[model samples]
Target: MQPLVVLISTFTLIFVASYASLQPAETYWNSVLPNTPMPKTIQDRLMSGSVHDWGVSKIHPDICAFYIFFPLCIGSNIKAKDDPRRYIFLTESDLKLGTKKNLYLMKSSNNANFLPQKVDDLDASTSKNLTVAINLLLSHPTSAEAKDMRNTIDMCEAGEDNACATTLEAMLDFTTSRLGNNIDTLISEGDTEVKIQSYSISDLKIMKSKKSIVCHKLTYPYAVYKCHSMSDTRAYKVSMVNANGKKINVGVVCHIDTSRWSPKHLAFEVLNVKPGTIPVCHLVPGDSIAWVPNEL
Candidate 1:
């Protein structure tokens, strides 16, 4: 009887080892292959850091076009009231609506900057920060919300999109909130209440003198964004007035340098101008954020 048990255990061990060996070397991490195939147009925009739409179809068509060709429209002196292009940007209400509908897709824009890292590969400081941020947002590190966020992030990192489909809001909120907290911490210490400033698209005004971080709301199953500071860029506060007359303040950023951008880029095509000839700008959708110095 003892010999039979030993033989069975040996066979189980061999089977497990063989199965693991057959898997890809990157099986241990989310998004094992970083260089996945993407559309040339998207790839070009990403490379130039001038992407307007991160494949989010939920946004309005007119608004999307405006974002794609903002450089042309803004330069043309087109008045928001006279211009046929209705700038109907998303609002807080729209964000909460249908939160459960598109989550099944579980697709990300696949931006390299927002990709999840393997737990083991994350530095000690980063891991600690993530844990602290999650706790801050969810109130308890071991709470159900925190657990869900951690799982969603892990799944997204592991390229298990299908498995991450259900908790789209949690994933989106966690990333944005964590980033917001980081922004607050960056600006001041000791639990400073971060006051985010917003502007509207209808009344676009640029702050040329101030440096700021623009967080653009990305199109995904849920809210996600690619926020960063751009050199040679200007920030604007655009007043976004929806059809219902509800006002939302939005952030807009214009890139001043396009000398190295691809000539075939959409901005050049839309504006009928050559690359490096003009500045390109786009609005920061609702639920997104931007950080500027408090003095401004």
Candidate 2:
């Protein structure tokens, strides 16, 4: 009994001295950076209840390995010493050819001192297709399309400087084209469902967690699209787990277009997807569960 009590006390002490003691992400930026200001957009991302561990590193003088919470997550990743940050702020305009990283807003007032680095594309097809799609939208688009494009570009600027979130906005139409209104129907069109490794959307596995956040960003595809001007999206509270196997609650948010339900008009139509059966893109509804534990 005595030993058990001591063990519990020690664990609590360690947690309080470590995770709880760390200040809000913005504090680190202010202490280490000159004239660091908090943009409302960045704050909105953080306040969404997702804080990613960006881990610490001495990669660059102007940069320490940190994160933008989940979207605007901040923190010193304490995992590997001197681990380099290979994070890329993915968005629609970032579809330029041949780059390790894609960034629309390279620097901003709030994160001026916290320089972000570049990394490789997640997939050539995704980037190339998205790039072509964005260009197409630029050519004589509808009033809404034009507004959407302008907003995405300006997302890099302050007040609403959240290029990552805007990236989702940019890709909203594309993902919708692929998934359409009934995601289950599209995924079931062929053996494509097997490739996804789960029949039920609930069974999908997560990224090979370098570490886990009890509740991670509802970073499902097309999820960011909900943040767009044309689409309707809202906040929903959810739970997730971290690398430590602890439970974490998070909010998943993204969509800007209305025909988000039509497959022909979603990602499929935007990417000009040809075919008999194309791969089913991830489509989490604005108010639905995007990701959850395998047990649930």
Candidate 3:
């Protein structure tokens, strides 16, 4: 009986080893290989950074505990209110009701001076549709402009992840945009070092009118307080994973007015994140508060 058991175990071991040995190197490596290289146009924009002179020099530490993200005011060209650049952040409605000629995606800058002093340029002429625009960006990534953008993003990535204002912004832009744009392909980009996972707002109840949401502003003031909660809010969950695979779950709420917008739901104000458990942002009691979109 003992000899029979030993023979059976030996056979099992041999079978396992044989199967593994027969596996093709490409097939084995493919499981761990990064997603196919992204097109250049999209890569360029993803690497792009905006020069943020407003609050680049400094940041607060207390707010680093919460996972809240405030809506940022952004435009292609900073036109005066009389010319208001049409809008700040791009929305789906803009695609149907407007065009990308005047739209500019918002990004943050972090200069190692503990401030962000440079901006990365983007060529918006890639495509008209958002999905196609992303694909086109992925396709053509070989120009000097693309190089410059990569330089900026790479600099920040190498810098302190949370300390540099631009690095933080760069992280936010890449995470949010990619997560929002394409989840499966989001983490496939080889350049970024952070790992992430997300939960959509489809089944989650993320909005409330009477509640006062909490957050920490990023710029000079680094305002920490409870923000006014609007009646209409669209949000989802994002898990910023670390090298060890631990997740920091964050509750992000966006103020999107779809009633009178270009797309069914256009996000003028991108999001108001709750400081649930993000390493960068923290929640604290406060006397000062502001409406993020209004601030934008």
Error of 1 at 228 (Å): 2.7
TM-scores of all candidate predictions against the true structure: 0.33, 0.19, 0.22
Clashes of each: 11, 38, 27
Where model 2 places Cα greater than 4 Å from the true spot, the runs are: 1-155, 158-195, 201-230, 233-266, 269-296
Candidate 2, which ten residues in sequence have the lowest lDDT sum? 1-10
lDDT of 3 by residue, 1-296 (tens): 00000111222232233212333323322343234233232223222222232232233232111212222122123223322112223222222211222221112221121111112111211112323322233344454333433332333233221212222233223333322322221111121232122212122222223222222222222121112223344333223333344333323333443343322111322322222211121112111111112110
RMSD of 1: 19.8
Best-to-worst TM-score order: 1, 3, 2
Per-residue lDDT of model 2, residues 206-278, tens digit only: 2211111111122211112222111132222223322333332323222223243454332334344433333
Q: What is the C-alpha lDDT of each candidate?
A: 0.33, 0.24, 0.25
Q: Candidate 2's C-alpha lDDT?
A: 0.24
Which ranges of candidate 1 are over 4 A from the true structure? Answer: 1-204, 216-226, 240-246, 294-296
Residue 8, candidate 1: Cα error in Å is: 30
Model 1 residue-pair collision total: 11
| Per-residue accuracy of model 1 over 10-50 as CA lDDT, tens digit each | 32232233212232223321232233222232222221111
